[model samples]
Target: MAAEAVPAPRREAWERRTTVPLVVLGVVFIVAYTIYVLAPWIPRGPGSLLFFALLAAWVVFVVDVIVRISLTPRGGRWAFVRTHPIDVLSAIVPLFRAFRVLALLRNVPYLQRRSGAAVRANIIIYGSTYAIVFVYFIALATLQAERNAPGATITTFGDAIWWAIVTIATVGYGDMYPVTAEGRFYAVFLMVGGVAIVGTASATIISYIGEKVSEVHARHGNSGSAASDQEKGPIIEPPGRAIQDAIDEAGAVDDEHGG
Candidate 1:
């Protein structure tokens, strides 16, 4: 028989339980991948070990995706896949697994707090972090891909870094550019990521400015109301301000009539 889908609550609980561990693994994977990319002189034995470790980490991520997919309700499995493109992509594409390091942001204490401001804060934090990491990795990967190729403009690490920055900013200045197929492939991703980061930052700034303007207007409106109240002199609240005030006013009226 086919496995039954787990309830949403249980799935969420599983996610929460797995987040930190996966983040830790992601960090390890990044470090290992970085070493694997930048260091090509290691002894065969150690290199093999590192290779297995990286493979193991990838397997874990793939298994995590499978488990989550299985837990999702049958009706919503497609929705889950649609919403979690990164997770799905990371599991399927080894090159994208580097992006998994982003999960580390969720473990930050300040971002973990539950507050109205936390959402925007998370966006800013994630977007900035994502851009930096993306730029660095793309630089390294592009350098690896282009360095040995004939007529490669981005032959050195510095050239690769410059190229990555310009490409990610969508500013292809032409001083440095990728010449290899793999390098060009990474350039495409960098451009897309750049557009996304720029858009997010722009939206966030506009949102914050709009909020500030509204707050200033609200404060001005409140102060104007207070000033108007003061200009009218004492706020001689109508006598029936409360039940007791009404009762006292009625008693005074009776006294005035000697009733």
Candidate 2:
């Protein structure tokens, strides 16, 4: 247990340092991919520069994956790699490389603490944050892969964004859907991711509300006990007598004489 705790903190620190840089790299990859997609509209030299830059960013992602695996403090590197298939797919597929940025969304294990409220806040924040990123990146990836394919309805970035929002919301209006293999693969990821976001947010909310309700009930219980104690006054030990109201001796004598 003690040894296991060591790796989590180190992994968290590494994640904090690298997560921002990974997002930046993802943005750069996005710009490069945009140029690559619009290659016909630009000069060949600038497009080639963008392509090479994109490749360099991919190299960075590859390095990031290797470092993460090394930092795991376990010998299951191959199993980890197999589980994180996105790392592999992003390295091999040019268009899919930008999607590797999504890995940053998954560092919650290290960021979470024992506080339920804090964990709940993290859950909602992470869920909302990743949902937004996925919508944006998945939109671009879907467009790049589907725009030129046969029977592709997502021809414009506008359509792509719209489709992405609908799909990520799990609305599926049927107005736009992926035609090619890459687009469909990305869509599947989007659907699953959307469901996960919703589920996390819902569970966190329920847990938070439950915690609050329990706290309120506990306070009420304490207050009720306090009121009962006040009604009874403070308890005295058996060796001492509790004070009573003073007797009216004159009035008692007058009442006895009248009797």
Candidate 3:
């Protein structure tokens, strides 16, 4: 039982140590990929450098996922996979290298230190970051896929980005659309991602607003109670004073009766 229990903690420790580093590497991957995609005419030397950088970051992500899975207890490996499908996909899927940045959601320093408002705020910020990163990469991928296809409407990077934005919002404006199979495939994922991002952002904002409103109400309630307490001051006399007054009245009644 002791040996069985050890792996879980070790795995948790490993994750905690690696989370920030992996997020940093994901940033490196995005930067390299962005340059590579946008500057197709760059000289071979710089291009190769970016390629290797992207590959290195991707290799690290793959290895991280493998290590995490190996550390998972045999009995719960399935659960780990089920719960961490995004991590698995980001590591395995070539295009999903961009999605590796989503790991930022796991252990952002600011988000980790607080709950409620702080967390909701971080979610909104990081969530927007993830969406922008996702759109950028998917746009590049779509551009590459559709660039050579006959009658492709998304030949340029700008058009690809526009299509991605509209598709993800489920607002296919009909002004830009994917023509090739690969582009359409990316489009499908982009659409789903858009819905998830928008939904999560909307929900987080609503929760933050609700929390603020509740806090306001709570402050008002406390102040109202304080005011009411002051207004209804001393509804009952102090026990000592009441006792003294009763004794004095009894003495007066006895004096009157005696007289």
- Assess every candidate by TM-score: 0.77, 0.67, 0.73
Rank by TM-score (best first)? 1, 3, 2
Q: Is candidate 1 or candidate 2 better by TM-score?
A: 1
Candidates, ranked, lDDT: 1, 3, 2
Q: In candidate 2, where is summed lDDT lowest over 10 consecutive residues?
A: 238-247
How would you encode candidate 2's per-residue C-alpha lDDT over 1-259 as one tens digit per residue?
Answer: 3333333456557778988887788888877777766554765353477657776797987887777778766755556666677666666765456655655555566445757766666667666766776787788888889998999999988999999888878899998999999999999988998898878877887887898999999998887877876686887655423222124566687899999
Q: Model 3 segments beyond 4 Å from truth?
A: 1-7, 16-21, 43-47, 102-109, 228-259
Question: Mind sharing the TM-score for model 3?
Answer: 0.73
Report the C-alpha lDDT of model 1 over 116-232, residue by residue, as the tens digit: 478789988888887887888888888888888999888777888888887777788998888888888888888888899889999999988988899999998887777775575
User: CA lDDT of 162 in candidate 2?
Assistant: 97
- Each model's lDDT comes to 0.81, 0.75, 0.80
**Can you list the residue pairs that collide in candidate 2?**
none
lDDT tens string, model 3, 1-259? 3334334776798988998788788778777767776777864363487767877887888898899989888876767777777688878765666666676565557777687767777877778877887788899988878887898888888898888888888788898788888888888888888889989978987897898999999998887777876685767989999999999999999999999
Model 1, position 30, has a per-residue lDDT of 81
